[model samples]
Every structure is written in structure tokens, then in C-alpha cells.
Target chain A: MSLADLHFFKMTREPSLDALCAVVAERHAQGLATILYAGGTDWMVEQEMRAPLHDEPPLVVDIGRMGELRGISLAGDSLRIGAGTTYLELERSAVVQARAPMLVRMAKDVGAVQIQARGTLGGNLATASPAADGVAALAAYDATIVVKSARGERRIAMADLQTGYKKSTRAADEIIVAVELAPPPEGSPWYWRKVGARRAQAISKVALAGVAVVENGTATRFGVGMVSVAPVTARMATTRALVLGKALAEITAEEIDHAVDQDVTPIDDVRSTGEYRSHVARALTRDLLRQLGARV
Target chain B: MKISLTLNGAPRELDSAPLVRLLDALRGPLGLTGTKEGCGEGECGSCTVLLDGDPVNACLVPIGQCEGRAITTVEGLGEMAHLSPLQRCFIDEGGAQCGICTPGMLISAEALLRRVPDPDEPTIREALAGNLCRCTGYQRIVESVRRAAELLREGAAR
Candidate 1:
């Protein structure tokens, strides 16, 4: 088939955030299925795959030009990133580099220049891929997602957003407005890694993000976020609890292996076997811990 | 919908849906075939084009998002009788193999050269990382970009 064959039947390019939200809310009231699009990087492919299964096409709302969702700002100690801000914008922003270099690094790792030029931070989260690099990175930052609708807006913890695979706490009428990020504590050691088929333009097989602060060689703060280890991106709560307040050097692998086992619930899929993800997740977490140990 | 943008240094307008892929707009109605499509998905950089002086995957960009923006396809780079330095380097250094990925590679190389006139090997590699060329295994392509950069620096290439 010609490349031109892929086309959306119904679409409206919303010029503002308020209009976008109003359209979504109106559609929800009428029970018309809607899919919000920003950057269309992989969303179009997703739509094409689902074409054979559905009798009707979802209303495609183009939230690409929402001005309210387009910049990075510092709200006192926290960084507020507009949901419509493209990866290219993040990667190029000097403010982002200084305040949240990990986010800049994450932006660079997202599908190279082409995808980065179009893919938005909020769009990646909304897509809610089980092993998305953005989700894993945001989880590491302990980011809070701000979503809005005609009704109002609310903040959802990254850890609390995902309920399961391809599902989230976000309602149909709501769209992500911004992602609020609190910078990691000064001098804290953080690690982010995405293992994929290839370095560039490949989806993650096992994505991991971690942060830790060792004061005089004792763990003061510890957190880990991993993708492809469960039905959704997961915060390694059990693992963090096990490692917190412990000496970085004395943290044992056997104990961590058990803690990670409790934290993640991986399953076999086309990308990888669950067993492999389990092993990689453990090894990578420990590797991050080791890095933090040496830095201290 | 009416989308107005600068294409190949000329201001043009397109009448189409808001979500029609820029790749389709280029090939179907605009009649510019230099931008090829390897994977209609954004995975392959075969449809890479310049949007307001930045390289982007045309396959993923909706024409509506391009309103009043500047687009540079491979055809905009140069003509056959008067090849751009990057295109000349591609031919001289055997950068293109099987020809499908050449347009994208040239566009990416052009963007890099425009930004960093004296880019190193690693820089060149990173710039063209998204554009995959299976035939030449990328050594010649990298060399081609390096050659173009040198010519550009010397003012011998335009």
C-alpha cells in the first residue's frame, strides 16, 4: 500500500488549551470516543494497527498548538514543564540543562532528532507504553503530572497515574497540562539507563531510573523507577525501602533480589521474556547502587 | 483546511485535512518525490525534512502543524545540474547505496553542517544516527558528511 494510505477520518486542530479541553469535554458528554494527538510520532501507527478492530474512528484532537502547554518554568524549587513542550525544546533549553539535566538526557534518548523534534513529554506519558523512557525517567524524578479538563485540573503522582497496561488515572475528558518536577537533592547520585534493540530509534526492552544520596556512606534517600518490569512503569518501593538508611557498601544482592521481586510484576511479551527483564532489572538496580557507592 | 508554508524557498499553500502526513502532502499533491518513505512510521528517517530550519520526520508531522512554517525537502537542497555540496560529497564518496536513504541522509547532513560547520566524526554520526543506510554500512555516509563539512568551511561548497 502507498504510504499515503494512512489517514485519519476525523480530526480537529485545536488552537488553544481551553478549546482543546472544551472539545474533549463536549465529546465525552456525547460519548464520542476521542484520541488526543500531539506530535503523532507513534500515535498514527497505533491508530493504523487498531483500524481493523474498530467500526468507528476516534475523534483526533490536535492539541499540538496549545500555547499554555509550551514552555519550561521554575516554580520556586520545582520545575514546571508544559505538556506540549517538544523533546527538541527540552533538549535545547539551557534552563532544563541546569535544573534537570536528567530530563535533557532523557529527551536526547527519545528516538533521536526526528522524534525529539515532534514528540511531547505529556504525549509520551499519555501513550503510557509499559517500557517508555520518559515514564521511567519521570518516575525517577518523582514527578507529579498536572492534567486539566473543562471541569478543572488536578495533580497526579507519577507513581499513582498508571493503573495497568495502557490505562491510567486520567479520565477521558482530561488532558495533561504540565509535568511538575522537583529537582533531585543536591549531590545525590542518580542513574538512568534504557536497554533496547539498538542505541538509536529503538523501544526499551528494559528501562531503569534511580536516585540515591549517601551521607558519609549511609543511604539517606533512595528511589528507583523501572519500565518493562510490570504491566505499567513502576516505582521500586519495596526495593527502595530495603536499601534506605543502609550503608551503600553493605547492601546485599540477595536482599535486593528479593526486594525487586516484590516491587515488579513482569510478564512474557514479544519484546522480551519476563525472566530476562527480572534479571536485568535486578542487575541494573544493583549496578546503580554500586555507582552511587563509589561516588560517595 | 488551508495550510500555508514555504516549500523549497517558495511560498505555497495546501488544501487538505489537518492530520494528513507532510510526507503525503509532499508526494501526492505537491509532486515533490525526493522525500522517500521507507517506513511510514517514524522509525526510518527516509522522510526527514527541514521544518523551520530544524530536521524532523515528515511522516510524523501533520501539514496543519506546519502552517506558516518553512519546509525544505531534498529537492530544495539542489538540482541535478547544480548539485549542493552535500549531494556532491555523497556521490563522490559513495555515501548513497540503494538510493532510498540518500535523501534523508543529505537532509540530516545539511542540518548538521548548517548548525556545526566543523563537526567531528562523533558529531556527524550523532546527527545522522536516525537516518539508516543498510547498503554502505554508514562509513561512506559519515565520510561524505565530513567531506561536505570541509568544503563548506573552505567556502568551496554552497
Candidate 2:
């Protein structure tokens, strides 16, 4: 099996989102493996090319050329991020910055400048990496993954989108169209942090995003999302339940520890040990809670 | 698959595999070898090029996705007779050592200077973060971009 042996038979450029969905549906009906591609920045192609093809190669469609899925906008309190929006777009988008600054920070820290320029938000979601930075941040906002096929469109919560590592719940015939996020209530404190091998161009060993609303020195709302600590980007339900309605001074570090243990069930992997991830996850949760609690 | 794109300021119509990397396309059919390949992966930025005025890793970009977009490689910046300011600065400031990282660095710096003509040191460092230099210790590379910005501004003033 060599790169030369791999055959790329067709590369269709869909001019619009509807056109793309139709093509994907038709391809799936014909029993051809179809993959939606954007920016072409993923290393998956290189790996796919190196493997010998036993039968017909999968049809690669470049949906980046689709004009509809190319920018970020806010409409009626919902932030709509087009699927083909690049990380650079996410970083530069004033709408994303103002509404979800944590997402902008996460986008900037995803990779170095090149990756940020070429890698896309939809690609990250579709790839469904447990350590995907964008997903981790989106979870904090309770984002919905909007997907479409020729059959119809569907919106899945970010919490339910990922089934496992590198696997998504999206159907083969569906393409992610956009991510919808509702702006948090006024004056919510949000923080995002990822511990990786290096500052840039490193996959996360563990990452966490926290959003909380504090009023009258008491927590009104809390949302904690973490990655590389679990199989999916999970909302820290236990942590949120424990902290919500509690006075900032009343919430203790021990509470965060107990909630982190219940919220995230980490497994040892090559990038990090389960114990180290658990430790960092607890420490980060406590630190963010303390800081956010104080800022109220 | 066939693609028609603006390459180096010229309209180019070329034949290529849809999934073939723009890196291979440039080095293969397009006949522009100025762009180097270090990691082949996007991390190295050795194959960086400007896609519609944005810096992107050419090695990771499939040529099929580049249809109708304007691409600017290192060769497009300048030539032997008249080097771009960034190219000249690299030579004057000793930014190029083994020369592998030079093309990508210049492309990234060009993109930066296009947006921020006089960027601070942190801005310069951030723009060139994707392009790695094994020989110059990056201090000289940063200096080269800073110097290039000055040169470009000076040239514009005249």
C-alpha cells in the first residue's frame, strides 16, 4: 500500500449548501462513501492516501466552495456560525468575539496561524476529536449542531453529537450546516483553558470551559464543559448542580473536586495519564469557579 | 479533476487529481518549486501560500478546493531581478540559513505586513508562529520581518 496506489476518482465542488446536501444524498444512495471536505487542512487525507484501496475510493466533495456556509452572523439572539467558517474567521469575527469570547480564545489557541487559517469549525465538529477545542467551548454555550441531508435538516445538541473519539452521531448522508448558539445572559463570566504539549499545534491533554452568572454574590447559573477528560465534550452537570444557587463564598474547593470526579470519567491515553487529567480537571474547575465567583 | 485558479497573478488552468495536495500540484504540474515541503503536514508551514489574501498551508490544501481562488506562492512575491522587500530583508538580516523555511516565512510575513504594515514584535512573532526556522534561532527571522516592514513602508513613502 502506497500513496501512489490510492485513486481519487472524483472531487466535486458544490456551489451551494443545498447542492452539497443533494450530492451527498445521491452518493450515499449509490453506495459510494462520501466525505465532506472543507479547507483540506486535515491530515486524514494523507493517511487515507497512504492506505491501499481495496475497492473504489471514497468520493471527496469540497464543500468549502459553498457560499452559504462561509461566515459568522448573529440573528435574533442566536449566533449562527456557518459550517465552513475557518478558525481564523472564528477568531476575527466580531459577532463571535462579542457574544462568545471564549470561542474566539479557543479558536486562536487551536493551532498555529496556518492551522487557524485553514482548519474549520465544521471540520473539527465532524471529525469529533475528543480534544477538539471548538467543541469544548461550544459546549459551554449549549450549542446545537445543525445538519442537513436531502431528506431534511436536524439539530443535535453538542452534548449528544459525539458518540466516541473521532466519531460523530451525524448520519453519512448529512452535512453539518451551521452551529447555533444562544447568547448567555448579561454579564456572565466565561473562561477557557487547554493544557497541551505546547502552546500551539498540540492536541489537548485536557481542556475545560466554564461559564457562570453571578448576581448578588450568589451563582445564578453555571455551565462547565470539558474535553480529553471524557469520551465526549460533556457538560459538568454535577458541578453545575452543586454550584448553582450557592453563595460565591459558600462554594468550596472540595465541592469542585467532588463534582469533577463525578462529571468527568477520564481514561489513560498516550497523551496523558488518567490521574493527571483528573487532577488538572479538578484544579482548573476550582480555579475558574473561584475566579468567576470573585468577579461577581 | 481539473482546476482553474489564479496562480502567481496569472490565470492558470491545470489538470490534477481532486484530492492531490496543492503542494504536489505546485511542485508537480504548476512547475513552481520555490515552495518547500518540510513536514508535509500542516504543522511546519513550509508549504505556506496565500489563498485569496490569507496565509494557508499549501500541503494541506487540496487543489480542487482552490478553484477560482487566487494563490500567491513565494515565487509570486519577487524574482532574481527584483526581490520583494521581505525577500530582500531576509537576505540582509540573515533570515535564511538552510533556506527551507524562507519561502513560507516570507509568505506569512507578507500576509502580516499587508494587514499590519508596522506590527509590533508580538504581532510579528504571532504571524510567523506557523513557520519554523531551525537555523536562525527565530530572533533573526523576527528581525527580518520587522526590517521588511520598515523597508516596505519606506518604499511606499517614496
lDDT for each residue of candidate 2 in A132-180, tens digit (9 for 90 to 100): 8888888888889899989998999987888876777899888888999
* Clashes in predicted model 1: 0
Where is model 2 chain B poorest over a 10-residue stretch in terms of lDDT? Answer: B15-24
lDDT value for model 1 = 0.84
Residue-level lDDT for A261 in candidate 1: 87
Which 10-residue window in model 1 chain A sums to the lowest lDDT?
A1-10
- Scanning candidate 2 chain A in windows of ten residues, the lowest lDDT window is A1-10
lDDT of 1 by residue, A113-156 (tens): 88888889898889888778888888888899999999998999
Please state the error at residue A163 of candidate 1 in Å.
Answer: 0.6
Provide the fnat value for model 2, as a fraction from 0 to 1. Answer: 0.56
How far off is residue B50 in model 2, in Å? 0.7
